[model samples]
Target: MKNDTPKVFKSIFALFVVAIFMIGLFYAFVSMPKGWGVNVNNRVSRLYILKNVRTATRLLDSGKFFAKGMKPLRAEVPYKPIKFKKTANLEDGAANVVTSIVVDYRGFDTLGEVTVLFLAASGVMMLLFGKRVKPKRKKTEPSLIMYVGTRIAFAVIFLFGIYIFVHGHLTPGGGFPGGAVIASGILGLFLGRNGYTPNHAGLKVFESLSGIAFVIIGLIGLFSVKSFLANFLPTGIIGNLYSAGFISLIYIAIGMKVGSELAAVVDSMIGDTKEEWS
Candidate 1:
């Protein structure tokens, strides 16, 4: 005998909202200009690929566009082509062009990405904030073989994560992936045992220091070269391990920050532990 009017109204309202959203999305898709972001000949894209962003900027500011019919094309910038394992002392000397873009050309965007991740992790911790205590029912401890195997595996996984971030400038993997790999290892640790609690205090300290290090590195670049996150240090040969200047250092900071933050998030989600960040 109960009325279903309220339920019907809610369903209708939800459908109406969804329809409106879909309509908007469809309109946006149809309105987008053809070949919106796929233009490889765009000036920004060209500069990014050329690794001569600084020179390009100066040239453009002096009214010298690279294309025809733009201020007489001032003096042509004789940019040497990049060669792997042969190029040396180039600007942003990262062998991996993507690394150069992410950490050097678009570093501000990368910082924002890290900040967003930090905020998400902080939200999880805040929502799950409470004193840790054992649950009424205890989880069964892991088997001996599982525990031993996971322990050994965790070491290798952790080391591999470090290597990924450290050699980010020379490889496809970077701080984000490296941190994710390390977090996966931490997750394995959780599965490797029952009632395993990570060092909450140490994690907090480590996360804070990593973020601070990233900011300090950017500030040093700002003061030294009047550009935030500039490659102020010496960029060695492109293929060398010590190349890419501060890009390597920044990736290290980002890896540590993301790894610790994600580990903390995982710890918070696996609540009912006896650890406090004190």
Candidate 2:
């Protein structure tokens, strides 16, 4: 006799996958896009606060202790700090203030950014890494309804994900947000159908290729300019998706890199094994 778990698990997964398709469809077709804006420009300035004392003679005269008490807060800043250098701006190539700042002035922050993406990918993969793998010949009884539905569902999901990342140049969603949407959709397939595994071979190709493209873009910058991610391409019109030139290209690569890796992880964790209900 065959195990009955695939029948039960398949129903659960089908519902889950359908739900993701609904959400992605709603976001892609119904929601309005928001305009791009940068964070507030923060600069250091001397702030003098005068407090009232009842008597002049009762005042504390120790400048050392007063400055010392607040020593930890002191930046020891230069007399003047330049807020704008005529180098890179969102107008220069990138649309995002955070990305421009992190990727340009402080590239170490971009390393941390990539590291965060890596962490998210790792956490997702880790969730199912410890589950028991199925025997090669284990019989599965997944429903045809769920299986066919998820196959179509994932196709919509993958396209929407690509749209999100591609339009990230002009709109609100970028690689991170887009990739997350894609992962959510991929997760649905895992939930809906047992034995219907995601295409790991294709996903691995996506991950590896996107990673190579990102590194090559950075290397291209290095070959020409002073830094690793220097802007060398023609700057298109400001605020246009295709206009930002290299910035748009870079974000798309990053989106592909992130979305594929995360999807692969989601696919892996959702196994075709039987789950015992409590």
Candidate with the greatest TM-score versus the true structure? 1
lDDT (Cα atoms) of all candidates against the true structure: 0.86, 0.61
Note the residue pairs that clash in candidate 2: 13-191, 13-192, 14-192
* Candidate that would win on lDDT: 1
Q: How many residue pairs clash (N, CA or C atoms closer than 3 angstroms) in each of the candidate models, in the order given?
A: 0, 3
Worst 10 residues of 2 by lDDT: 47-56
Tens-place lDDT digits, model 2, residues 3-100: 56677789999999999999998888655544534211122112110101111113234333245455533232222221332223332444554444
Model 1 ranges off by over 4 Å: 1-38, 66-79, 273-278
Tens-place lDDT digits, model 1, residues 1-278: 38556878899999999999999999998866567556555445566676777787787777656566654232355467998888887877888888899999889999999999999999998878878887565557679999999899999999999999999999889999999999999999999888788898999998999999999999999999998988799998888999989999999999999999999999999876553664
